[model samples]
Target: MHMTVCLVLAWILIYLCVMKGIKSSGKVMYITATFPYVVTTAFLVRSSTLEGAMDGLYYMISPDLNRLFDPEVWLDAATQIFFSMGLGFGGLIAFGSYNELKNNCVKDTVYLSIANLLTSLYTAIVVFCVIGFMGHQTYMDCLDNDYKTLMTLYPHKYGSLEELKTSIKLDEYIFWMEHQFHHSEFPLLSNASRYCNYKDIIASSAQGTGLAFVVFTEAILQFPFPPLWAVLFFLMLLMLGLGSMFGTLEGVITSLNDSHVITVKKPVLTAVLCGTACVIGLLFTTRAGQYWVSLFDHFAGSYALMCIAFFEIIAVIYVYGYRRFLNDLEFMTTERPGKYWTITWRFVSPVIMLILFFSSIIKSFSHHPVYSAYDPITTAQVDTAYPAWALFVALMLVSLALAPTPFIYFVRKFKIWKIEGDIPAASKCLGSTPSTTYMLKSEPSFNRMVESTASELQTIGMNGPSTNGSARNSENDRKGNGSNRHPPKRN
Candidate 1:
């Protein structure tokens, strides 16, 4: 019931913020977007003072060139890029569609891309710094525990300063201390020492919600004034989450509006959508919610994203025709895309995306879906393998998300084939004609408009302003009379 209330409140907040479209949401972003950066910067600055903070920073930025050779690493990098840029999600596209027809999207794209990359790097720095402090604290705690044990066991061994120096070989003592603690018995201490040496807390980090709610919260608690920083950190996370939700929700609302499938007032439509989503979201608040969330995240969140992206690229580049796409861009931007953009859209991106998609599928099948289940009383890790039926359900969820891509593709193909079947055999035998010919054939009215405009210009040039008035009047009459007619062919 508590979770239900929270979910309802969240949806209410989202609906209130975005019901008026960008007008309300854009104003909300002033705080939601900027406040996180301020909080993150504060965390980063505070973390720098902690011991071993540089180690964390070094681990983050120092590249292992050999890791680049691993396909999994490349896949991970691509996934990060896709998520950070919100690519393939339809959210960015929906947001951009709200802009004016001639908005400078090229500039906006470049700026936003760079900003996204920088923000990701900055957040990594802040996260790693906290991790570094956590590592330092963990090591100290382990050492303290070991010292207490030794004092309890052999108090007389350290009774005199001279005896203490003579009896303890520092290297031997250090070795014994590390070897004595069983990781299961002292999980935090054991892991802390390992993380300190390797400087790679990220490797042990949790995925999805665990990283945000568990790992980050754990790190925040290590700071001075834990309550204050914890509040600030979570508040920042909340704002960022709300901001993202706004975009995604707005995308759905805008899509429905554009489709004309919901013929209600905007606010009424928004309320219906948000209310439905809230009710559906109640499933995630159940006792088994975590497992369901894991399933959804694995199948819908990861696999469906790549599949959607692959189809989107194929549709734009192949179905839409590359040259026609470029012409559309030129119309909006007044500048044609350069060679690099052309090559990427046509070849490079599609190939890379296909590889990633296949690789993900292969990886998914190779391992059964397993999530960590902890004992509530003792907090010991228990491996929980998803049941076979759950796996099937996950696959179904992925299929559902991916259903539209091929369904739409085949429907479009069938329509094209049906149209071509009506064309004469002779024209069919001539093979695929240029898209320009097809365009002209499809829009006879456009051809007439062009011809009429050309004829008007020619008359003005040939006769000058003395005869311009009469020529213009006649042309206007012709346009008014048969604006929809194809102009008669000139020999």
Candidate 2:
């Protein structure tokens, strides 16, 4: 019941913020976007007072150079980078589309990129400090209780309890004791150990939900006014979640509104979208919600994002033509892109993404897919191979995202599923868009481009060829220093 209420309240807040479109969401961003930084800053200061905070920071900086060779490590790093920067998501593009044509996109990109990188690094340092504290606290608690417990269970190992205390300095005796009580000796120890060594905590680092719920919650209890810190931390999380949600929902709403797919008011569309999503979200509020979430994220999140992102880079850099893109940027900024942009677009980004995407897939097939399964009785997680049904579900989830490209290709090419081009509702469909304009005005290139889009270009560009289809004019270019000769206008 509590979960249900929380779920509803969250959706209600989302609806209220986005109901009026960017006007409402923009105002809310003042709080939602900035509150996380405040909480993170506070935590950074407070973490310094913790018993093992320095240990955690050191754990973070210390590198595992060997892991660089592991495909899984690269895949994991790519996943974090993708989600952190909101790559493969159309949210940032949707928000940027609102800016005027002459907006300083290059400057915005550089500043935001640097800010995001620094923020992610800072947050990692802070989180590791808390995790270090958690590890140290656990070790201390174990030390406090192990003496009495060890005396009761293994009195035969020593002459007396006092003897056992003095012999703790003896490596053999301590190792034997850890075997009886903890079984957490260096060679034997894994993340499943009840007590952790702070130095070894990197292997057991809690992340995502575990970091937020278990590590942070326990660490907060060690602070002076746990309740106050708890409130602030959770409130920060709420805002962080809402900040991301706003962009995702805004992207969906704006695309639908711009596409002119269905005739509906913005407020009504926003309500319907949020309401439907909230109802679907209830599945995630159940006792098995975490498992369901894990499944969804495993299948639909990483690989799908990689696939979409790979294709997006291909579309923009290769199919759309690189020189054309660079030309557009040059026209808008009045300065040509440097070698850095060229290297990233032409080679680096795509190669890295493609390698990561395919390497992950190869690794999955090579080894059975295993997820860390929670053991309720012991309150520990065990790495368990996905069951048959779970594997099927994972396959289906991936298919839902990826099978469409080929399906649409077959349907469109074979004309098996004919789209009535004359239909009124289809007037503003993407395939039939008249919103685009040409850049390369060579007769062959322009005609080829027009022919590719076909009849749709006829609606608006019918008279375009008659006059001067070779070039188009400067509506805002002069005011903005030739802001691009042919910027595609979207409603």
Candidate 3:
């Protein structure tokens, strides 16, 4: 029920922004894009100051330099970069389209990169800090623990069984439980003891997997100003998620819209697409809701972004012509784009993308564990099954692959997709528009007819100087003579 509401509300907000067009959606994007940074940063600062936080920070930053040589680490980093920056997938291009033609794409690109990097760093800190407090040795181990033990320990342990059963202050019970975990060395001790006490370990394990729903709800309920804080937190998350989603929807829609096959009526088209999304979302409300989401997320959110980023790099630096790209940078920063960006986009981006693509492909094909938990539908299996979720992801990838077919055909047929003939190109659509001449000449027949009609009007009502005769026109009047001025001449 909770996830359902969140999903519904999220789609509702995204659809509303689409109704406003890409330009208006910029406000939404800006807010959403910048928000997670603030939250994560705040949490990071708090986390970093906690005991043992430095150890976690060190663990994150001091990556095995050998991991760099392994190619997989580089791939992971690149994938993270692409996803965080909203690169590749039509999101960036669509957002860029919404920008002023004169707006600096190079600067925007750099700024976006820096912002994403900073956010990731902050997130890492927050993640590590929490893990450090939990005394987990590695990220994978922490993930295995499912981030629940800390949040739920207090609620389950601090309150007596009677207190838990009889308390009207459910929030207090949760708080009490969390406090126990916060102050206790149970998590660390569990790691040290290898969870020898099997019963307690199993209980802790159960809490970890269910934390997203259970403990998170408990934390929210226990807020000092529950109503206000809950409103703020949910609204903030909604804005952030919607902003990201708006970008994704806009990218896909623009890719189709620019082809001219979808028609140019943006308002109606946007509403329809968003409505369709809501209907699709309804599929996740059933018994396999989580499965559905995970499927879409795995494919569309991860690998798709990598592919998109690869193509984006190719388009920007190679196909667009690097010197021309340099000029875009010069216009924005008042200095030429550095050599580093050129190299990054050209050589580095593609290589990184390839590595990530191959790594995922290899992983999928390998006999490695699929790492999933038991659900109502299926027990925990060694290999992830081709469940509904997998099918969902497959559909998304297939759609992405096939999406350009009609678009390519349309552009070839109508020539509406050219940057000069079409509009400004960018990763994110940014209030982009057709060229001014295109706008003026769009109604070419009407313009031509108007000009012809004006000319014909000029030829009428000029027959004579005294009235409306052709003989006494401006030429005759200018010469101080009128061919039909004399009445004798009329006879």
Candidate 4:
């Protein structure tokens, strides 16, 4: 129920942002993009001091060094780079379009990419450290354990530095860690198992076929808080999530509006669409709601994103031509874009995206190992004919395939709206008069003839003869000396 509420509220926030201009929405995102980094840093520093945290870090890195040999690993890495950097998404293009032409966008992109990578590294360090402290082999294994048991395994320090130092030990800690991994079944484990078993029962008991409230009830126990930090983290997530969703929903809405299928006022449409989503989200209080959310998240979130990214890469680099695209890039950076960038944009990124897309497809076909504690006696009922997960994946693909239909129709009927029946004034004025603002067909300002003419004219008649007393006396002497000019002087 809480998850449903969060998702709905998140969607509503995005819708609100769409009603307003995206430029106005970005101030909130600047904080959202940085909050996770801060939290991860604090956690990393704290976890590194824990007794078994090193063990967790070791296991995380130990995942077959040979996995690097597999092409799939390279593909996965590429996908992560693309997804984390928000590449191949029109969001970057749209945001870049809004940015002032003079802004140094290449530097900003470089900085943002590095920041994202550093944050991911920090998060991995913290998570691995927590795993080490708990002596777990993998994250999924830890998740399977009782949440309370995992919480207690952490070395919480409340004393002076010396006391805290004394609490850290090799032998005693190893003994406890061994016992944790080998012997005890956590008391809460049984309770959690019961909750999972009761999922269907709880859903049936709800007003309709809704989500089990037990999941939401469990999550409230997991809120990590230093009241202020909690507030900051939650608010930051809200902003980040809203920013992403707003960008996506805006695309969807704009596409619809352009198609002329939706003619309502922008604000009104925004409110109605968002409000309807909220009301529909209330259905998440049932078993079906949980099922559907999981489906949408897994399929749309994973596979659909892959498809969209690949398409975006092809469209921009190949279809649009990287040479022409370089013109747009020049406005964003101080340095002249080099041959290396052209090569990467035209060839490398697309190849990477294609590789990742194929890997995802192959992985999807492979069987996922599923285990369950409950196998009912007697005639066992397969609650679902196929895994509910398949349903979700199918729905995701269907949704994506349907996304382009409106665009096709919109392109076909684009001429239906003709606000100006006559030619625009600017077009009419094009040949009729010379525009003061335009310098079309103007001569080159630099000219040798004009420059020489100006220099020659600067001294005017001064070069011909001096008019000063000395020059006048010299001229009279020349005539009196009776040279060729003596006859003229006599007159």
TM-score of each: 0.76, 0.78, 0.60, 0.57
Worst 10 residues of 1 by lDDT: 466-475
Q: Which runs of model 1 end up more than 4 angstroms from their true locations?
A: 62-73, 152-156, 160-207, 375-378, 409-491
- Write down the RMSD of all candidates, one decimal each: 9.8, 7.6, 15.2, 20.5
Model 3 Cα shift for residue 140 (angstroms) = 20
What tens digits encode model 1's per-residue C-alpha lDDT throughout 1-491?
99899899999998999787766788899999999999989988888888868877877787889977665566667767777777777788767754544456789999998899899989988877866666666666655555555555556657754465456565655555556633544344443443223333444556567777876788777677999998898889789878888778777775565443355766788888889989878999999888788778767777787778888889778876899777656645669899999999999998987887787677656887676777788676567788899888988998988997777567546664232212221111111123333443454443443454566334222222221122011122222112111223343
TM-score of 4: 0.57
lDDT of 1: 0.66
Each candidate: what lDDT? 0.66, 0.70, 0.52, 0.48
Tens digit per residue, CA lDDT, model 4, 1-491: 67776767676666656665454456656666667667657657766786656765776676667677665566556656756666645456545433344467778878988888877777667655654544422222333343333344432632443453355343443443344532343343333422221112222222111111322122222335446544644554565566665655555544343333565665677677778767766766575665556455445555566667666667667765565456545523436689988888778866876776676667655645222222357433234344766665566565765476455446434855442211111111111111211221131221222243344222212132111111011222322112221111111
lDDT, residue 65, model 4: 71
Q: In candidate 2, what are the lDDT values of residues 69-137, reduced to their tens digit?
A: 888788877877778777777787768765544456799888988998999998988898888788777
Q: Which TM-score value belongs to model 3?
A: 0.60
Pairs clashing within candidate 2: none
lDDT score, candidate 4: 0.48
The alpha-carbon lDDT assigned to residue 63 of candidate 1 equals 82
The Cα RMSD in angstroms, rounded to one decimal, for candidate 4 relative to the true structure is 20.5
